[model samples]
Target: MSVTAGMESGPPIGVTAGPASDRGEIHNWTDLFYFFNHSLPECHVELSESTKRVALFVLYLAIFVVGLVENLLVICVNWRGSGRAGLLRLYVLNMAIADLGIVLSLPVWMLEVTLDYTWLWGSFSCRFTHYFYFANMYSSIFFLVCLSIDRYVTLTSASPSWQRHQHRVRRAVCAGVWVLAATIPLPEVVHIQLMESPEPMCLFLPPFETYSTWAMAVTLSTTILGFLLPFPLITVFNVLTAWRLKRAGRPESRRHCLLVCAYIAVFVVCWLPYHVSLLLLSLHGTHIYLHCYLTHLLYFFYDVVDCFSMLHCVLNPIFYNFLSPNFRDRLLSAVVHYLPKAQPRAGRRASSSSSSTQHSIIITKEGTELTAAGPHHPSLHFQAPNPSPISAPGSLTAS
Candidate 1:
């Protein structure tokens, strides 16, 4: 009776007593269907309690380790690198910080899952634990949006006037993003409290009508802003960037294409099912009566999809930042600095180190510099058979 006629767990609807509980069992061969509406088979849930504990423990433990190490590595490199801080670097740093929030907060939920969904932590812990879960999710999303906007600005409006004010504008936008993202979890934090079903569970709001209202409000806001708002903007901006690149006779790098494609795919694929289930549960404020089996199926789907959504935090850096050579170089440099064999060398050792580093589409005659070709920071290159003639041997700046 997790969700009863007067209680709401997630769905903003009242659930009637299940058929197994509502009717008497037939001992002998009886009517094929005791009730016409109850003829459908019961929605089966086969995962045992022990199995769930093991699965969740493994999943959360793995995500925590990978996400922690990767995000920390990213933050360390960008902050301590010799390269001057750029708009892109700043965005990546902020995103990494937000992701750390998610990774650090996962342990509380994992502990609860391990205990068979019991809330050993008291009322205060219940609200606090859930708050970080949502805060980081929204923070990561908006930071990604800011990165896209910065890239678009860099490519199209690199004039002198824009350059004068660009740094200040970027700083302000970053602050605003943090403020808004932090504010999103306040409503939930205020209302969430501990509830006991003999095992003690953390329920967001009270049961029945109030619970339904609260759930609908939270899910609708999350779906509308988190997915609907940012998704369209990301798509439109990327499309326009691509079209502009094509018209200018510049082919996008495979790595850049893969990064953007992965971002869009993961954002949509992981989140769509969760929102769809919420919509079904919240149809007409839970006024509509859906079949019992269908409700079970939707709830199950929602739970499974949620696990996938958590994985986005773990993979974001790998797809977007780790693929960049500049990023990797910076990360390696930062890491080596603390090692025993990190000392600088002269003569043969320095020459050997220099020889090992190589970049395609580059010709060094004197000064060598690298700049972002697009949002991705791809190597500056042109498709001409002899591109060297256009920029000479020393300079290779992409237009």
Candidate 2:
């Protein structure tokens, strides 16, 4: 019942072809050379079914464990009163929540993959799992977009009236994001079904008459909404923010610019290949007859890139929270607060002294002050960084 068990007897997964009569003939020497060069290696370079199962299980399990722990820490550190007040912090917290949601769905997926794509769970579970996973996927990326925009606005806008109304604006934006994310996955809930023929499997199957059209539509929609639109916006805003900081001539602006570039690079490295594969597969589905070798390559390519895309859940916290000195300070304080009383007083004193030596000032362009305290003074205190409404960038705030 393995999904790949009968691959030689049928078309590859996620690919559909026209009839044999419509298949193109290699009528020239050039076509033959192209096939030998491009398609021959794919025939020999494939992993065994057992190898793929074990590799994917281990990969997803690691993502589940690490993503769960780190995202939970982010939520705990940011759930405190002071962390709840800022637009940037709010976006970070919500993004962590969305990443956690995706992590929670991994166990079920791991189980299904281990069972060779079997759907032991009923139809309702199938629909719900797909819905939950896609919703969080959309929301997580949308929050990153919001974070980029907020960083740009923080650097550019300094009006007192805007600051007064930011809380309402933040709430409205978060709510709208959640609403759109929830709505986008309705198709999954409606179209994903638990198939019982040949063997029980979960798949997206529409009416036979409209299968190709539906498949192409879904692929295009996901690519456009998930990557095509949001990525450009994220890049533009982050680049502009970095450029503005560089122009301000702050000592830390170079480092801030580098961090901004890192954000953009990671997003592209993780997502671009996956969306590209989706688009290529959709094109092949439109009754276009790709060579057998190219079809196989596309199938394998999709699998690899899809797994790579899930890595963002693991990387998000590191780039967005763990990189920040303030977040690290908060995490350490939280850990020390929960330690047992039997711990050595000498060790605690050592920690206090070490923390006292580490000091940094973070001044937002809007004049908001953020102070990270020593171990003895565990609470963070916020105030105005400068009397002037606009000031130079002081420290890079990790998104």
Candidate 3:
């Protein structure tokens, strides 16, 4: 039988057996329930060797690339466009930036996971990684909520004061959001410790005994703030906006309201299950057989949900680049400049020549003097060969 125990903080916490051979530490490959103390089901781990590595690489990289490119584009487009600097886009820009910060930490996690969940990076990175992960998550959620609120305000209010001092509103919203996001990592800094798992995992200190309480609290808070609270507000505001649009008989408003409503709905549906699973996994007696089964199912599904939800960062750029007219035009212009030969304009040669010819017309009108120039001319010679002191509508030389 292989030895099983939590080794001191170093390497991976694997079993070290001797004599015949070393099986290493027995990792709890079973679901959360098994880890908690539930009846052990047959190890149902499904990630294959190659798949795990590829997935780790792809998920982190996609998050980094998509979020970075999209947010950067958002900033550039907004900067160039007359799109008024409002709280909504400001929050969006900051949110995107925060996501980039989180994405920057992903390569570290990716490397650690690929190396069998052992953090090769030291505790400094561990803490920082955990810090930014939560920070980005909170900022994204807060910004989404702020966006919904901004839309609601635009739809609901019509006061002059609201319109006149909108910049102050945006500033306050951004400041508050930044403050909230920056505080989310306090728990991570408090609870994380260097621990030896069968896989040399760096986990929350005190194992489930202490980690469970903190994890549950943090996850529950994140769930409530990130999904639950925002979902209802978004739904209610969108519904009200829709009702008003219908009453006002504006088709465009109705369409916009419906689209935003759908976005909020999808966000809630995708993230809710994952948060619920996290909350349940932290509860006492979660290691029981039933809990283990549920936890495993949820854990697997959580990853799937996250993979889909990560599309949020990807869609941000699309929303700015494709949905927003200003952003779309700028992107198109930039792309055209970058690859001018990719799309040739039809009849461009003829149109350009005609335009140049039409632009050369010069007309001069004076008392009893009229002159006209052709569509193309180097210069117009205006000369009265016969000195005519008589100023009348004589046969003027049409140059």
Candidate 4:
């Protein structure tokens, strides 16, 4: 979500154009500018500019290709069987779409980094690119939170009233999430501009009169809304979900519970470093007397972690869809459907075996019957007596 380009030689707004000698004495207004520009010449000793550019180009390219392919596969596979739509499927589809949005923006970002943070595109692109990236980033996080909450809710409560309105409620929640995600990036659209400083670059430059205050506000707000607030909610809900699954005393409950915990672990590993860097940058912007070396080090740290955060776009599909047994079955069915001749013998054997096997039924708290084909298929495939939807196995659902 932090799409701003690396700083060049330009003096950002609100910073006085002073001699190199004054660079040693940092002020609040100049701190952000210096932070981006890496005012200390010694910092260049860590990695040469050419090396950094090549490394970033490689990273962005890899993320773009892998994330694009993974999310597209998720969307394509899930898009089928619309008649069997369920809340978990809807969440997976939406989350894949969000991750795809983030992946699509990577090429432009790749080009920007390759050009040494130059913005060859004009003003409209500058705003739209940042807005699109941030919106999807937030939406992806929100959808994960939704997935967590849905897992916990379905596990603990089975009120007739709640079950009756569950689909409608989930639809409304998805719409609200999309709207909130779009709204959160409006400040970026306003503040981000194509600045033709030392070189043309897309940068977030607030008004000069309120530069420091605005910068700090934006940093803190993004950290809070994007990570701080949502992460705790995700952790709590997933933890409770895992706990409930463990108490269920089913054979597959342990594996299912660990998968649930993975949701929290992956989110934290991918996002925590980036938010910590943002907090450090925010602290530096407060004129909190950091040594010159430390300030430069922070800048480098931020750049690394910012790119590192993008691993979520790639990992989301693996965790949310590919890991689910039902989704895998669906994907295989889809593949075989399209390529009928590819595995005819195996398909026949599988179909015969599945049809002949006796299904074991597990009753939920609401007394809904879940039919499992055999021991090989650990998930209890939901078969509601009513029209309520059923979720894919291993998708935050206990078997």
lDDT of 3 by residue, 1-399 (tens): 001111112211111111122223334332221332332233564544456446746775777677677767665554443254222445556656665665565566556545644655576765566666667767766676666556556555667787677658877887888887788667555555544444444555434334335445555666677777877775665565456556665546545554555565556655665555545534423333335445345433433344445556666555423454434555565555455243333444563564222232233222122211100000000000000000111101000
For candidate 2, what is the TM-score? 0.79
Give, for candidate 3, the lowest lDDT window spanning 10 residues: 376-385
Candidate 2: the clashing residue pairs are: none
Cα lDDT of all candidates, in order? 0.55, 0.63, 0.47, 0.63
Candidate 1 structure quality by residue, lDDT tens digits, 90-125: 667777888888888778757765665567778787
Q: In candidate 4, what are the lDDT values of residues 1-399, reduced to their tens digit? A: 233444354432212323436556555434645554564344443646677667867998999999999889888887885446445567777888998998898888778767666778888987787788888888888888887777567656657777678678888988999999999878756887776645566666677656657666776777788888888888887777666656666567687667756777778888887777666655553455456576556554455567778888888888777776566667777776676343223233563475334343332232232422110000000000000112532235311
How far residue 202's Cα lies from its native spot in candidate 4, in Å, is 0.5
Worst 10 residues of 1 by lDDT: 377-386
lDDT of 3 at 238: 52
On a 0 to 100 scale, what is the lDDT of residue 238 in model 4? 72
- Deviation in angstroms for 39 in model 2? 17
**TM-score per candidate:** 0.74, 0.79, 0.67, 0.79
lDDT of each residue in 1-399, candidate 2, tens digit only:
112212322232234443324445544323332333343343554647667667767887999999999999988887763344344677777888998998898887678668766678788887777788888889899988887776667667777766677667877898999999999878645866666654566566556446556666777778888888999888888888778778878788888778878888888888888887667755764556566577566654454456667788888888878877667776876776666544223233563465223333332232234421100000000000000001124544542
The alpha-carbon lDDT assigned to residue 262 of candidate 3 equals: 53
Name the runs in model 1 displaced over 4 angstroms.
Answer: 1-49, 82-85, 206-209, 251-255, 284-289, 342-399
Error (Å) of candidate 3 at residue 87 is 6.9
User: Against the correct fold, how does model 4 do in TM-score?
Assistant: 0.79
